[model samples]
Structure formats: structure tokens, C-alpha cells
Target: MAFEYAPAPESRSVVDIRESYGLFIDGEFADGAGGRIKTVNPATEEVLSEVVEADAADVDRAVAAARRAYDRVWGPMPGRERAKYLYRIARIVQERARELAVLESIDNGKPIRESRDVDVPLVAAHFFYYAGWADKLGYAGFGPDPKPVGVAGQVIPWNFPLLMLAWKIAPALACGNTVVLKPAETTPLTALAFAEICQQAELPAGVVNIVTGAGETGRLLVEHPGVDKVAFTGSTEVGKQIARSVAGTRKRVTLELGGKAANIVFDDAPIDQAVEGIVNGIFFNQGHVCCAGSRLLVQESIADDLLAALKRRMSLLRVGDPLDKNTDVGAINSAAQLERVRQLSELGTSEGAERWSAPCELPERGFWFAPTIFTGVSQAHRIAREEIFGPVLSVLTFRTPAEAVEKANNTPYGLSAGIWTEKGSRILAIADKLRAGVVWANTFNKFDPASPFGGYKESGYGREGGRHGLEAYLAK
Candidate 1:
């Protein structure tokens, strides 16, 4: 019998979710003009909270509030004052770290370990990093002084609810722009909780507004005539729509979209380390990452050896409870997302690829899919071309370095890629050849607030972290 670990679940006592949540506009929780949507815990299909749906009227209110805050309060505030507020927000986030982590895991269907260690910590760090830049914009490489654009409209996805919020809001605030943000309907609890944090930090009214709803809410927010800047992190399809909507307008826009990243492993690479990196690349966060390395490109010479190790390692992954501390993978984010994974995986099989999944018992109540992989995958395969955005890997072997580069660059996405090789020169050669914004060598799934993150080509444009991110909110 395979060894089974005892359950070690994280306590939900730290978070106090209410029966219903409302639109967070002007630093207050108020009802939306639209109806309510029930946000469920994907791990158990439990109704976590009913979130107010923002209609066109609500979006207009948020934009007007943000415009008011920008014109009268946040935009004119001294950099030092803004810095102090950001620092205070960061400190409060850290103090309530456990609560936020629990809330994120419950709403987003990610394992507790990831919510605590990766999502929440990074969320706070992002604020802290940008906070220091608030008072030091003169040295931020954006020329002598950079002014924030007027009211920014931001829309975030369910994958990393709180982290994406930090990504959008921190830099906007640092550059002195007030914002109206919308969290995805499937996961709005944490973003609503963040309103309480802004209150704790005593951030000015309308400095940050969070409207909760589906695509319709985001659509109206982005299309609002009062919004001077738009920042979105989600599907490529929607990214294109937003880009088209702002084409003839003056609103500055940035999109952090999807990826079908390739994780390449060479014959001479360390077998064990490469296996770990492969697992981390695609399996991390149930593979909900926008930059998840979903495509595995192994050199034909070591394909057999590398795959053996990868399969053996994949077999050990723990799947089930998001709250379980020992879990390696959790439920898919929602029913619709799970259906997409199933459809794509089926397509991969129909296209003549060998499909394999890790053995694990899934909870019957919630959305779930075991860690899966497809070998014998070719560039012509749909799985190899499109973004699965789930814990599914497509394996394709490359016979030469040139062939590896060719296969990796064939995708429309240019978000992220991984190269594993003991040879430094070869790593540099491959890295230089691959057309991706972020390249990981001998490592995968690493992120830092100081590092710039975004994509090239159709994966979407504009940088989201580091000094480049500051440019997004500034008047050039």
C-alpha cells in the first residue's frame, strides 16, 4: 500500500467572512445597483459569501469617486505622505497575514501552504517594495519626476486574488494614481477583505475602489470615459477586447495575459533537480499561473531517463483539501475552469498524445482534476499550442538545440519559458533565442517584486513589476 499522510488542515478561525459583501467604493462597503453573486469555495462547493455585482451604474460611481480622490486628495498628496500610507498598508497586511492567507485559499482553491508562503507574503512584499519607490521617483529611471495618470481601472482574475490586487494597486498608488478595481466573481472575498485593510491603514477615500462581478463589470469599468488608465490580468481573449476598446482613446493600458510556457530539459542537466523544477513549473498553484510552464520540452537524448524521473516524482503529489498543509495540489478554481481542462485534455488524447495522470482520490463535492501529463505530444497538437491553465503538462521531445528553440517560439504567447542545462553557454544561447519576457534557467516558478514580469507578442504587453511597472502609471 502507498503511504498515506494524516490530515493537517489549516484553521479557518483566523478569517471572519460575513454572510454578504458589497462593493468597496470610496473606502466604504456599499451595495451595488446590480444583483448579487455567490462566491463559492471551489474545494468544497461551499457558498463562502454573496458579493455585490457591479453594474454600469456602479462602475460609473467608482470611476467618479476615483476621479474625485485623484483631483482633490491622492494626486496632490506629497510623495512622502503616499509612501507612509503604503508602508502602513504593508505593515497591516503582514500583521493580518494569517487571516488573508486563509481567506485566499478558501476563495481561490489553492493549497494552504501556497496561500501562506507564496501568495500572501508576495502580496505584502509587493506593497513594501513599491512603497519605498513612492518618495524616490526621481531616481526610478522615469526621468526627474513622473506624475500619476488620472483614475486607473484595474480588473483581476481568480487565480491569485490578493497577489494580483497588490500587483495592480501598489504601483498605481506609488505613482500617485487613485484606482477603481474589480475582482473576479468566482473569488471576491479577499479583495473585499482588503477594503478593511485600506480602512486600517486609513487610506484616503476613493484612493482604491474594488467592485466585484464578472466580465460585464470589468467591461463597464474599462470602458468608462473617466478612467484614464486600465490595467488587467486575465485571459488573452479579454485582453484583446480591452486593447481594441482603448485603441482610439487616450487611456493607457497594460495587460498580463495567458501563457503556454515551455520547460526545456537537456541531457546533461542534473536529473533530480530538473524533475523537481518540472513539477514546480506546471504543478504549482494547481497550474493556475499565467506563466505556468505547461509545455515540457525534453532533449531526445535523455527523454526516456528524464520522463521516468518526472513520472515517478509526479506520483507522489498530494491532491484534495486546499486547507490541508500537506497538500501539493488542490481543486481547480471553478466548475467552468475544470470543464475547460477536461475538454483540452480530451482534445490532446484525440490528437494522438499519450495521457497520464497521478493517482489520487478527489473529493466528490468540489471541482477537481488530478495532475496530468501528455507524452508523444507534437507542436501540431492542440495541447502543445493552446494554454491549458491547469495542472496538465504536454511533453514534446526536441532532437537538437535549434529544434528546441523552434518549438518553444511557435506559440503566440511570449510570457515565460524555462531552460535546464549544465552548460552555461548553451543556457545563454537558448535563453537568447527564446522570445519570452521572463526566462528561468535551472529553476522555475520563481518571482520577486523587484523583478519585472509581463509578456511579449500576443501574450499581452506592458510590464507589471520592478522599475518598468512604475512607468505604467506615470506621464511620460
Candidate 2:
């Protein structure tokens, strides 16, 4: 396949602070305290914008606004009226999808194809899906008259910025809760864009507030006494800290965290399809996906054949400019994250895992890591046990179905898992036994608005999509 290069889109000037960003508070844009942070494009290592960094005082102000909205406006609003606002927001999202997609690609370093086609569309769909449920909470199986928990404090990750915001905010609003949302420090552009959509939707003042900042702001939002519920999507380590921080509070918490999912291919599986699934499982979004199937567990009988096919498929992947239609992988999200991936990959080699990479050239000025695979990996190896969260795959082999199941469930994280087999009975039997939240039979990384998504164990608690997601925002 021939590759093409596309010019980077003109980014809004980083120095022009007003055009770049300010905190979205009380349904309007407002300057933060003296704190400000420069947002960088990880792909090109260029500064994109100077975003207002919400300090502890700003967090207090945002939380107070959210609390007041919950007490006076949003919480008291009728469910049908709340549904109308969500529906309007959903429409605005679709109308402005292109701009959001472009901004997301520049800010988060994900491919334009993904942000345009996958993330932006899914975000709009999520709002639409949840909007309809606002007035139908009686049918959501959360009891007869389910009510919103109150003000919600939501913190989303940088991987899928707009989509994560939708995942967090949609359900909270649908359930009648006002929200104070914090986008990841590295990628706040789309979240700020979503605030504009909320304004266009004419959502009630203080119903949704976007506070841009790093860990300290997140900590303040999560620990705020006025916030009645907390939702977070990020690493397990951070999720655990949030869990501990809110242990005895009146706040309800839901966490969608890290994963080291297993992609198991049985001897009876179709080699071509299994290979494609393996590639899509780990390499999608430059392997920045939390539910990425980073561990490849192939049956020993066809291990060599499958590995060869996978390698050939991987070699064809295009890695460069996110805006190019043909680019399969894009840049890493940040310098720190890239360094983490490199360090973990080095540990894989030190711990005796044979590493392999296809012949590919990365961009000269960007943070890029080639698609990497480690063979001869043992279950005890650090690469096999930890979540690398990049385009790095560790291969392992199992001799029997029992062993496959054992190895797949060995990890503490269980967000999702993929199973490939031609045998229907085997697929069902293994699917029933797998400990993960989502089981993709013969397919990997498939998402739908109607289906629920979450993790079972240390991958974190609570569901993110479908009818089950409403439970997180509703009062028990």
C-alpha cells in the first residue's frame, strides 16, 4: 500500500490564552487562578495551547457551582427537561464533530481517522443514547423512582478525551446530577470544546463545569465534600488512591482503570482472522487503549503459524502523521508516557523476553514508538504482568484449554479479553469462564452504545455504557 503525508492543520496560537482556553464554570468561560499550563502536541513535540490550570480554589468554586446547580436548578429540573438538554447537546456534538475530531487528533496524538470516525461519532452517539434514558429511568432496573445522586465529580483520561467525557458526563446528566468534570492535563482541548456544545445546547447554568488542570485539581475535585458522586477513568494506581481517598465519604465512586487483557487464539481458530484481531487488539490507537489485548496467548500447536501471519500483518501498518488516511498508528500521547513505555519495554528485554519490531521509520520530531512484540515471554516476566499501555505485545503459549483459561485469568486486571476459535462450543465455554468484563468472541475491541463496558477485578469497578451505566449516577 502506498502511504501519503498530509500537512498538519493550523492550531490556535498557544500564546493567545483567550482563544486557547479558560475554565468552563457556571455555564460560561472564566479565567482560572494565576496558574496556567502549556498544552503540547505529543506527536510533534509542539506547544498547542496555554490552558488554564484550575487550582484548589478554582476546584472549590467549580464544586460550589455544581452543588448549587444540583440544589437549585439541575437536581430540581424535571427528568424530561433534562433529557431535552442532553438531546440538544448530542445534536450540537454531531454538528461540530469535524472540528472536535481535528482538535482531538492534534491534542491527544491519536490518528485523525480514529478521532473523526470512531471517537467523535461514538461520543455523539453516547450522548444521544443516554439522552433518551433520562426520562426513562423507571425502566433502567434501578428501582421504581431512581433519582440522581447529586453533584458528580468526573475525571477522564487523555487516551479518548471527548469519548471519555461523554462516557462520564452523559449518564450523570441523564440521571439529573450536576457535574464538575476535569479533563486530563495533557489533553483538555476537546473537553473545552464539549463545554461550547453544552452552551449551544442551552443547558442550565452550573449544570456542567469543565475545570482544566493536573493531579492536584483532580485530587481536589475527587475529595471535595460537596461532590456527591465521583467517576474516574485512568490507571489502576490512581484509581486505588481515589478509592482510598473517598473511603468513608458520602460520595459514590466508579472507576474504569487499566487492563492487561489476554487475546487467546485456539488451535481451531481461523489464522487470518485471528491475526487481524491480534493486530487490532494491541496496535489500535498506538496501543494507548486501556482495554488493549496486549498479551497474546496462542495455542502451542499453531503458535509458529499464527505468529508468522501476525508479523506479516503488522509489517504493513503505516505509522506517521495522524491526519493521513492511511496511517494505522499515530504518536504517543506525551513525552512522560513515551518514556514510561520505553522503560517498561527495556525491562521486557532484561527479564528475558525476546523483543521484535518490524522495519519502520518514525517521524523525526514526534514522540513515536514502533509496534513492538515480545516472544519467549513467561507469565512471571514484568512485561507479561504489568500494563505497558502502548503498542507493545507480549506473546505466550498454552498447551490446553484449561491452561489457556488459567493463563488468561492470571492477571489482576480484567477489563476485557478476546477469544478466537472456530468452535462455537469452545468459545462459549471459555467465555463463560473468563474473568474479564467484556469477552469478544472472534472479534476484538468492538464497542456499541447498547452494550455495557467495565471491568471485574482490579481493572476497577462500575460499568460505563448501556442501561447498567445509569446505576452509577442513580441513587441506590
Separately for all candidates shown, the number of backbone clashes (residues 3 or more apart, or on different chains) is: 0, 0
Could you tell me how far off, in angstroms, the CA of residue 72 lies in candidate 2 after the best superposition? Answer: 1.9
Relative to the true structure, candidate 2 reaches a TM of 0.96
Mind giving the per-residue lDDT tens digits that candidate 1 earns over 1-476? 56879999999999898999888888898988999899899999999889888899999888889999999999999999999999999999999999999899999999999999999899999999999999999898888977889899999998999999999999999999999999989988888889999998999999999998999989999999999999999999999999999999999999999999999998899999999999999999999998999999998989999888888998999999999999999989999999999999999999899999998888989999999999999889999999999999999999899999999999999999999999999999999999999999999999999999999988899999999999999998
* Off by more than 4 A, model 2: 1-19
Off by over 4 Å in 1: 1-3
Candidate 2, 286-372: lDDT as tens digits: 999999999999999999999999888888888888766667899999999999999999999999889999769999998999999
